[model samples]
Target: MSAWPDSSSIPASETAVANKSEGKSTDEKPSKGNREQIQVNPKVFNGETQIEVDGITVDLRNRYLAALLAWLVPGAGHFYQGRHTKGTLFVISVLSIWMLGFALGGFHVVYASWYPGDKRWHYVLQAGVGSAALPALVQGNRMRLATDERGRTRSDYEPLWNGFMAPPHRPVLESEADEVAAWYARRGSGYEMGTWYTMIAGLLNFLVVYDAFGGPLAVPISGRKKRKSDSSASSSDTGEASAFADAV
Candidate 1:
C-alpha cells in the first residue's frame, strides 16, 4: 500500500486550497442582506409634516386639504391641524376686515359681474375668501334675467335672497358717470374704502391658505445671528484676522 493518503479521501475544500484552484466558492463568506439590524422609530414620521417656529411645533396634516379648508374659511385649516392659536388669530383678523369692509360698503361691495363700465374687477381679489365670496356668484345668477316655469320672462336685474351680493345695475345701460354719481351719493367714500378693505382681507386669507399648505418660513429669527456672533467671538479668541486687523 502507498504511504500517502488516497486522493478520493481528500475533501474538495482542502484540495482546492492546496492546488489554488480558480473555482466558485461554496458558503465561505456571509450572505448579502438588504435589511438593517437597527431602525428609526416610525413615530417620527407618522404621516404629519412638522415644522418648528419660535419654539412652537406646527404639525400640518394633509396640507392640500388644509389649504382648501383655509381658503373656504380663514383659519379652518389651522383648526383642523390643532393649531388653535394661529387659527383663532387668523379667523379674527381676516373676518374682522371682511366684515368691516362689508359694513362700510353697505354690504354690497362684493357683487360679481363682468359688465362694461361697472366691470367689478375687484371681485377677483375678493373671491380669495372662498365661501365668503361665493355667495356673490349665486346672487349674480339670481339677478340675471330668467323665465319662470310659466314661460314668462322675468325682468333683468331681478334679485332673490333680498338682493344680497347682487350685481349693481348695468352701468352701461345708462351712463358710467351717472352710476358712479349714484353710488357716491348713496355711500360716499364708504364704497371705495369697503372695496379696498374686503380685497385686503382676501389677500391676507391667501397668505393664510399658503401657510396651511406649506409650513411657516424656514428662516430662523435669531439662530443665524446667534451662530454668527458665536463664530466671530471664537475667531477673535483665536486671534484670527478680522476687519479691524485688516484696517490696521
Candidate 2:
C-alpha cells in the first residue's frame, strides 16, 4: 500500500470543505454591518464586568451585586467595582449626612410609623439611606403591638436601642408621656432638620446605587455639546473659505 493517499482519490466537494475548515480562504471580506460587535475585557477598572461597547469598559464588576452592595451601604458598589475615589467620597458624604440627621433628631428621625396621624411620611424618604435607616424597621416590628390603654395608639414600650427608631405618639394623646411631644419640646425643629438631612442622604445613596449598576454616562454632557459646537464651527469655516475662493 502507498504511504500517502492519492490526491485524485479525494472528492472535490469534500476537498473544498476541508480547505475551508483548515482556514485557507479567498480575499473576500465580511461586511461591516455583519461584523461582530466589539467586546471589551475587564482591565482598566480592575473589575470583572465585561462590556460590549467600544472604549467604555469601566468594569462595572457585576452590576447587580454592585447595586445590592450600594443599597446595603453607600458607595460599597463603587468600592467593589474598584472605583475607590468615588466610593470614598460617597461613604463620607452619605454617612455623614445620615449620622448628622440621626443625632440631630436624637435618633428618632428614621422610624417607620404608618399609624394614623403618625403617617411617618419622612420614613419613606429616609429608607433610601439603606442600613442606616433599616434598624427603624426592626425597632418598629419589635414595638408593633406595644400599644397603650384602650388599645389606643402610642409610642411607649421602648424596644431596641431604647426605642430609638420607634413610631412617634400622636400629639393629641396626652401630656409628658407622649414621645413625639417630648421630641418636639426637646429638639425644637431639630426633628425637621434631621429628617431632611437623612432623606437627602438616602436620596444620594439612590444615585450612588444607580451609578454602580449603570456605570458612568457613555459621553459626558459637556463633552458632547463641545464636540457639536466644534463641528459646526469647522463647517462654517469651510463654507466661508469656499465662498472667498469663488469670489476671488
Candidate 3:
C-alpha cells in the first residue's frame, strides 16, 4: 500500500481546495453583477436611437435630410436632431451676422455679380448661407435683364432696376475725376467690411451643416484601457499604503 499521507497534509490540501472554490465564487459574483447591471442599463453599452423633437419622439435615421435641412436653414438640422440649444444658438448668431451685413450694405451688399471679376468670388462664399443669399441672385439676374447687349440700359427696365445697378463706368471729365475718386475712397472700406461679415457668416454655416450631418463631435476614449490604468494605479497606491502601515 502507498505510504499514508501525513494527517497534517490532509487539512492543508482541504484548505487549499476551499480557498480555490471561494476565489472562484468571489470572481463569479462580480461577473454576475456586471451582467445584471448591463441588463438593467443596456443603452450605456449598446447604441440606441433617442432623438426627440417638439415633445414628440422621431427617428433620425435619415442623415441626408438632416444635412439638407441644415444647409437650407442655419441650425435647422440640430433642431430636427433634438439639439435645441445648439440649433438656437447657430440660428441666432449666423442670422444676426448675415442680417447685420445686409443692413450695412443694403440689398447691394449681398447680391451675386460676375461681370466684375472680384465681385463674383464673394458670392460663392455668401451662397453657403443658403436661401439668405438667393436675393442677390435674383437681383443680379434682374440687373442683367435691364441691360442691353450693347451695354446700354433698357428704358423699360431702367426705372425698376436703376437703384439696384452699380454705377456705370464712364469717361470721367478730368475736372470731376477727383470727386468720383473721393466718393469711392470714402465708401469702399464700409462695403468691404459688410461683404466680409456676410461671407464669414456663410462659411460658418457650412461648418454647421457638416456638424449636423455628422453627430455632434466628441472626444473618443478606450473604456477598457482607461479602466485598466485606473485599477493599476489604485493597486500601486494600496501597496504603498500597506508598506507604510507595516513600517509604522
Candidate 4:
C-alpha cells in the first residue's frame, strides 16, 4: 500500500476497515470522495396579505330626529336622540334659573307708587313673560337647525324668515304713547337680553351635539409597498439543514 492513511489519522474504529480496504482490489475499495458532504441553503416563508375597508357616510335623518324632538320639548331632542343625561340636565338648568329669577323678583314688580293692580304693572308682567318664553323659543329654533334631518343650517331658513317672508313690521310709536311706552320699552329690553342669552345657550348646545356626533364621511387607507429582496444572501434552507446535521 503506498502512503495509506495511518491509524491515528483515520478514526480508531475506521483504522481496522481502512487497513483492510488498503490491501483490497481497487474495484472493491471505498474512496475518500464517498465520505465528502454537501450543504444546501434554507428558505424562509412569510404569510402576509393586504386588504381594505369600506367607507361610512353620515346619517342626516338621525340628526334631524334629535333636533325636532328637542324643539318640541325643552330637551326632548337630546333625550330622543339617545342623550338623556344632557337633555334632563339642560331642561332642569333653564327651568330652575328662570323660576328662581321670578321668585326672587317677586310675583309682582315693585315700583315707586303703583300697586300690583295698576296698569303700570302690565309692563313688568310682560317683561317677565317674555324673559321666560323668548329663550326657550330661540333655543328651539336653533336646535331645529343644529339637528336638521337634511343637515341644513340656520342660514337655509334665514332666507325665508329674515327676508321677504319676514313677520309683520313692529308697530309705530305715537307721540302721546311715548311716556307710558318708554317704561314698556325698557321692559321689552328684558326679552331682548333673554333672546340673546338663549341664542348663545342654544349655540353652545349645538356645539355639544356636534362634538358628540361629528365625523368625516370616510378616509382611505393605502397599503404598504413590498420591500426588495437581497440577491447575495445564502438560502435559509441550507442553514437549517446544517443546523439539523450538527444537532444530530
Candidate 5:
C-alpha cells in the first residue's frame, strides 16, 4: 500500500477550508446539560440598571398563611416567610408595647365598665387601649406590603366598607361607642352592645394578625405571574448585583 500523509501534515488553512467544504458546522449545538444554563440580564428600573440573582422569581406562595400567622401571633407572617428573626422581633415589639400600655393604662377598667358614654370614650382613648388593635394594624399593613397584588387594600374590595364613606352617614363604631357610652350613662341597653363591640374588635384583630403573618402561601395563578422580576420581588433586590436578566 502507498503511504498516506497524516492530517497533521496538511497546512492549517487547507484543513480549515476542507472542514468547511465538507458541510461541517462551526456552531455545534450545546449538550442537554449545557442547554440548561440560563443567562439573565440586569434589571432596569427608573432609568437605572442593576444585576440580580438569575433563577429566582416572585413567589406569592403563602399570603394567606402569612395573614393567618399574623392573626394567630403578631409577627408569625414574617416568620412563615423564612424570616424567623424578623417575625420574632415584630411579635415581641408589638406585644410588649401593647401589653405594657395595658398594664399601665388601666385597660381592664375601660373594658369592664358599663357606662355607654364611658365605653365610647374609652374606645377612642384606647385607640391606644389594647395591644390587640395596634398589632392587628401592624399585621394588616405588613400583609399589604408583603402581598403581591396592588388592589388588596382597597376599601371597595372589602365588604365592611362598601357604600360607607363620607356623607353616607354610616354608623361607625366610634359613633356607636359614643352612643353606647351615653346609653349606659342613661341606664339604657347600650352596655351589652358596647361589650360585644369590644369583643368583635378583638376577634377582628386576631384575624388580621393571623393573615398578616401566618396566612397560607398564595400560589401564583399563572406561570408568568410566578415569574415576577420587580425590584421588590426578592430580599436581595437592594444593595446587590448579579449576572441575570429580569423581564419585569
Candidate 6:
C-alpha cells in the first residue's frame, strides 16, 4: 500500500468526483432573478385586464349599467362607450322608423291596451324602443277611463273611436250588420300594418341596444388563412420536386 496522501493532495478520482458534484450544485440552483421571474401568476399572460378607448381606460368588470341605459334609450350605451358614430346612426334610424309608424296610424297605434279581448302583442314589441313608445300607456289609460265595465265606449268618448270603429248608423235591414263588420275590417287592416311597422322599429332598436352593450363587433383575423396557404404552397413545391426527380 502506498503512503496516504496529504489532505491537500487528494486522489485524482476523488478530486474529479468533487468537481462534478460542485458543477451540478451550481447548475441546478436557480439565481434570485430567475426565481422571482418564475413566481409570476400564469393568468397575467392570457389577456389585458382593462380596455383603453379614445384615451379613456374602461374597466370591463361591470357592464350591466351600460345594458340598462341601452334599454332605456337606443344607442345611449354606445355613446357612453365613446362610440359616437354608431350611437348617432342607431338613434336616427330607430327613431325615424318609430316616427314613421306613429305618423301612419296616429296615437291609437301605440296604445298598450291589453285586456282579455284586446291583447295587443305588437305593443310589447313597440315598448322595446324605450321612452318614445311610453306615450301609448297614457293613451291606453285614457281609453280605459272612457270605456264602460262591459268594454263598450262611453257616450262621452264615442267620438274618440269614430275613426277607429264603424260609423253609427241605424240598420234598415237585417244585413246592415254585415256592412258595419266590413267597415271595421278595413280599419283593422290599416291599424295592423302600422303596428307591424312600429313593432319592427322597436325590434331593430333592441338589436342596437345589444350592440352598444357588447361593443363593436370584432374584425376576423386572416393570419391563419395566410399560414395555411403558405403550408399548401410548400407541400406542392415538395411534391413537384419529387415528381421531377422521378421523371429525371
Candidate 3 residue lDDT tens string, 53-163: 111233344567778888889988878876676788889999899878766654456666555322457778878888877666776677567767765446675323454
lDDT of each: 0.73, 0.71, 0.61, 0.37, 0.41, 0.58
The 10-residue segment of model 4 with minimum total lDDT is 41-50
TM-score of 6: 0.52
Ranking by lDDT: 1, 2, 3, 6, 5, 4
Pairs of residues clashing in candidate 1? none
Best by lDDT: 1
lDDT of 5 by residue, 126-215 (tens): 333244544333433343443334322334333222211101111214555542344346544444444444444444445445434322
Better of 4 and 5 by TM-score: 5
Total residue pair clashes for candidate 2: 0
Worst ten-residue run, lDDT, model 3? 217-226
Off by over 4 Å in 6: 1-62, 155-190, 218-248
Q: After superposition, how far is residue 19 of candidate 5 from its true place, in Å?
A: 45
Candidate 2 residues lying further than 4 Å off, grouped into runs, are 1-48, 51-56, 153-156, 169-177, 220-248
lDDT of 6 by residue, 134-161 (tens): 6667656666677677655566753334
Model 5: residue 7 alpha-carbon error in angstroms: 64
Estimate candidate 1's RMSD in Å.
15.0
Runs in model 1 deviating more than 4 A are 1-48, 53-56, 145-157, 171-181, 225-248
How many pairs in model 4 have backbone atoms within 3 A of each other, for residues 3 or more apart or on separate chains, i.e. clashes? 10
